[model samples]
Target chain A: MDFQTILILAQDAITNSAIYALLALALILVFGVTRVIFVAQGEFVSYGALTLASLQTGVMPGTVWLLLILAFIAACMETARLLVSGARHKLPGALATILAPPLAIAALVKICTPLHLHLGWQLILTMLIVIPLGPLIYRVAFRPLADATVLVLLIAAVAVHFVLVGLGLLFFGAEGVRTPPFSDAQFTFANLNVSGQSLCVYATTIVFVAIMAWFFNKTLYGKALRAVAFNRNGARLVGITPHLAGTFSFALASAIGCLSGLLIGPITTLYYDSGFLIGLKGFVGAIVGGMASYPIAAAGALMVGFSESFSSFWLSGYKDVVVFTMIIPVLLWRSLTTAHYEEEE
Target chain B: MKQFLASISMLAVLAAGTAAQADITIGVNLSSTGPAASLGIAEKNAISFGPSVIAGQKVHYVIYDDATDTTTAVQNVKRLVSENKVDVLIGPTTSPTSAAVIEAVAASKTPMIQLSPGPATISATDEKRKWIFSAPANTTIYGTAMINHMVKKGVKTVSVIAVDDAYGEVSTAAYKTLSEPKGIKTLTIEKYKRTDTSATAQVLHAMQGNPDAIFIASSGTPAALPHVALIERGYKGKIYQSGGAANAEFLRVGGKALEGSFMLAPPVVVGEQLPDGYPTKAEALKFIKAYEAKFGPRSMFASLAWDALKIVEAAVPKALKKGKPGSEKFRVALRDAIEGTKGLKGAGSVFSMSATDHSGVNQLGMSLMKVENGKWKLEDHAEFK
Candidate 1:
């Protein structure tokens, strides 16, 4: 490849790496705090992008109904748990928190749809509709099995992924949709032209990463989540509820996944089931981090993006096989370098 | 007269006491919820307009969503054959699933009206295709039309990128086979997964050759990715799509970037623009009118499904006279009747099925179309043969 082509392909890989980095961080974050593999984490990306597409077209997004339905189920589960535990006093507040966001968002979507709200409002609305789904998923599917083995939780996560995929098809229909780019402007540097959408992705990724760094190091809930990540029983002894930590981390993960979707939506067409492969690539990056370090995971995702970009160029037919096969070596190094510990369960 | 004939067949078909013969069941397996849903959903939606009663006996369609997975498609085919006792099978849409279910259908001796990518070259000696007939134009017809078009335009070098599946593999092969003999040198051939979110590497690789033209051999909206990416990079050469992106959605998805690109759509899609002497024009106009009247917008895939049933409808009466509807003999008769199809009007093509040619559509079945201002405009009424 010539210098210009190399530069262009690198640009493409970097744009992809930005999104994969977010996904890796989300995967790592969820796995750390919840001990759940969080396989359905990618579904949120489809949901976020699709919901925005629907909203942009001035129609009520299917996410509104999905959110309400899931919210109702979450409310019932939380209500049932509270009654069983004799925490009846906490029931009203818990129910309000569980049920209100989806209902309010549904109402907002219904109200604002015909108004043909601008893209900014629509994006915020999209986030509002999809973000709560994270915690709600935790409540309905994961929280009930909180004490279960990681394998069981992993299976549940996969099942949830399939269910979400089916639901995505129902809501979004079979045809994929692409949103207009955030900005259509082009930038050129040293004979290399870059798209505005790529810039948007880069800016958003950096800002989100910085915010995540700050949240983990500075905020109380973030510290609680970190404490929970470090030691569940130890944090519980100090009055940190692992349940809250799990929900918080899922929320963060979903937010990251949703943003990744938004970032990548304009760049390509995302089908109902596109997120799994994207998320799997991120998981490969997480493996690069040895599932422990955020910085290494992000860098690994860049490596994956570069390899994927270059390999597809060199050997287009075997790109996926090449990209997925990357996990083997990182896994080998991981197994060889890390000291094995007794089973956590 | 129709009612009288129907009543006669219904009465004759119902012999309750001994292995009671009943409805002419057509088992449909489609990928309505997965990657191939673009093709499957349209076909599924068009099922509502299918003829309910053929030759005076009720036609029962046992539709199942195979979710675009081959295993699920095979299972559905089994259930449709053994459980439903279908007289014929309509789908297992998408090429891989269609190819996968061929063995099962051949085993059960049920005739299928294949709806996805027609194989590039069906060997006349192949026994498996005996019970199978396709609804759409095959890869050879598409590849030939595209190659001939490129040849007409004096294009000497080309690149091809297709989905890394049964359809793409065959189309890429067809391009190389057809284009090379036509004096066009293929610079590169690339493949990407159908469910892939991006085609950066494939696009970059394809562009590296800087060939005179690029042929994207994928179907549906996914085809738009490389097109859009190519446009983004300001690659100003001609881009061609196969018949797979005939739907309006491909145009919508790709939007402004797709303008001026060429695609080979079945002549039915551009029926109004076709010359009156064309065989499929009248039926094409009728299907477009009827389908759009119900569904609002016209769809190419939907018309493919409609045309499959048209062939089935034409064959049923002749097949009905031979044996009872549920009998294996009736399926055999149906298969024979379908194979005997000659000069029959369909939405996609005037099918002329025979012993050797299952999807008996020639180059005339497809027309060269281009995206002009985000809509499919007929470029050449391709009668290349």
Candidate 2:
């Protein structure tokens, strides 16, 4: 290939890698603190994209209603628990917590949707609508089973994925929707011309990664989360609440997933089920990183993007097969190198 | 007195059963809620406009959603044949689903009219296609038209990029077959999955060949990926697309990147732009007006479905003369009547079905369209062979 061709192909790989990196990081964060393989990480991506699509059309998305319902259920569960324990004072607080956010969000959506806000504000609102479902779902489905084995948690994750997919169909129909690009400029350098959307994707990914690095290294909450990941029982004994860490981790992962979806929406037409395949690609990257190291996961995701791009050039029909087959070698190397240990009852 | 009442009741029950059997049923299996739902929805809307009464028999439609799944499509066909006992069947909107249910339709001896492009293998011989008829023009006719246009333009080398699916495989193969015989060199062939977000590598690889033109064989919004990639990379060669991209949705998603691209589409796509002497122009315009009035827009798939129902409408009266619609004898007569269709002008084409040719629409049924100013316009210089 010529130098220009090679450069263009590399650009494609880097753009894809940026999206995959976000997904890989989300997977690692959720799996580390919660010990759950989040199979439905992709569903969050679709929800975010479709939510933006609805908002663009000036309609109140079904996601807003879903969030309201889930929050109400979670609040009711907490309230019921407090009442059963005869903690009458906490019941009022529980009710307030459960009822306030949905009411506020609903009112905001009701007022702003018809005004047809700018794309930037619509995207922000979409993220705000989607991010809380992460923690609410945890409280309703996963928190009760926090002490269960990883296998059971994995199955629950798969079930959650199906529910989200079905809900996605209901919200967004089966037709694919494409969001407007953040910018419409085109930059030409020598023989290559780059779209403004690609530049936005790169800048956003870099900024988010840097911010995450600072958060994990400098913040107290981040340290608490690390402590939880290191040893849940020990963290609990040290006065760090494992439940808080779980909620925080899921909330962060879901935010990252939603951000990735927003970034990708303008670049491609996305259907309700598109997220599963994209998330599977991210899972491959996470697997390569051993699901622990953020930097390694990011690098692995870049490798996946590069491999997919080059394989499409060389063996176009088998590019997906090639990228997916990469997991086999990484698995073999890990199985041979890492020591196995049983959990203590 | 009790015996007399029982005998009268039995006679009434028999009469009711006979009346029910006399009603003609048209079974419809479509992907109403899956990846191909847009096409299926449009087709469903078109079929709803079908005549409610034909040949003094009340026409009843039994519709099922296959969700674009192969197994579900086959199951729907079986149920329609065994349970509904439909005299005629239409659709399962996508090509893969349509192809999957062929054997069941044939085994049940029911006449089926598919609303999408299918492979020649499903109707390669008269015996194979005895009970099946395709509504749209064959893929080969589209390929031949495109290749003929290129050959006339003095193009020598071409590259192809297609989705790695049945539709892509069939259309690309047809292009190669037609182009090769006409002394055009196929430089390279590349494939990608329909869900792929980027086509940079495929486009870059095709650019290496430096062909005169590139053909993209894909459907819906997926068709825009390669076109955008090629334009961004500054490859200025001609781009041609398959008939599947002939829809407003494709144009809406593609935007300015699709400008200057050429496509082979059924004449119904540019019905208003057809020449005054065109045979199917009046019928096409009438159908387009009715469809757009009801659905707000006319799509190529909707027109295909409209034509499929029309073909069935024309054959019903002839079949009614042989036997009542519920009987197997009537179904056989209907199949034969459809096979004998000649010079019938519908929305998409002038269909001429014969014993050996189930896909009766030929090259004349197609028109070359150019994407100009974000819309499909008829190319005046298009030569029909």
Give the winner by DockQ. Answer: 1
Give a tens-digit lDDT track for model 2, residues A1-345: 879878888989999899888889888888888898999998888888889989988889999989998988898789888989999898887788777887888889889999999988998899889998898888888898899999999999999899999888887876667788889998988877788999999998899889888888899988888888878888889999988889988898789888888888888777788888888888888988888888888899999999999999999999999999998998999889988876453
Per-residue CA lDDT of model 1 for B1-385, tens digit only, reads 9999998888766654232355788888888877677778789888888888887888878899999898999999999999988988888677778878878988999999878765532433577768887888878888888888888888888888888877677778888888777889888888888667678778878887688899999877888888888888878899999877787778788999988899997887878988877878888899888888887777778887898889899999999889988899899999999989988878788788778888878777888998887777888765522
User: Model 2 chain A, poorest ten-residue lDDT window?
Assistant: A336-345
lDDT (tens digit, per residue) of candidate 2 on B132-240:
8888887888988888789878889999999888889888888877888899998899998776778889999998868999999997777887887788777898999
| Tens digit of per-residue lDDT, candidate 1, span A1-345 | 888888888988999888889999999999999889988878888888888888888878887888999999888888898999999999999999888878888998899988887788888888888988888889889988988988999999999999999899888887888987888898999998888989999999899889989999999888988988888888899999999899888898889888888889899998788898888888888889977799999999999999988988899888988998888888898899999986565
User: B-chain TM-score, every candidate?
Assistant: 0.87, 0.92
Off by over 4 Å in 1: A338-345, B1-41, B44-89, B100-111, B120-128, B312-334
TM-score of candidate 2 versus the correct structure, residues matched by position: 0.93
TM-score of each: 0.90, 0.93
Error of 2 at A135 (Å): 1.5
The candidate that achieves the highest lDDT relative to the unseen native structure: 2
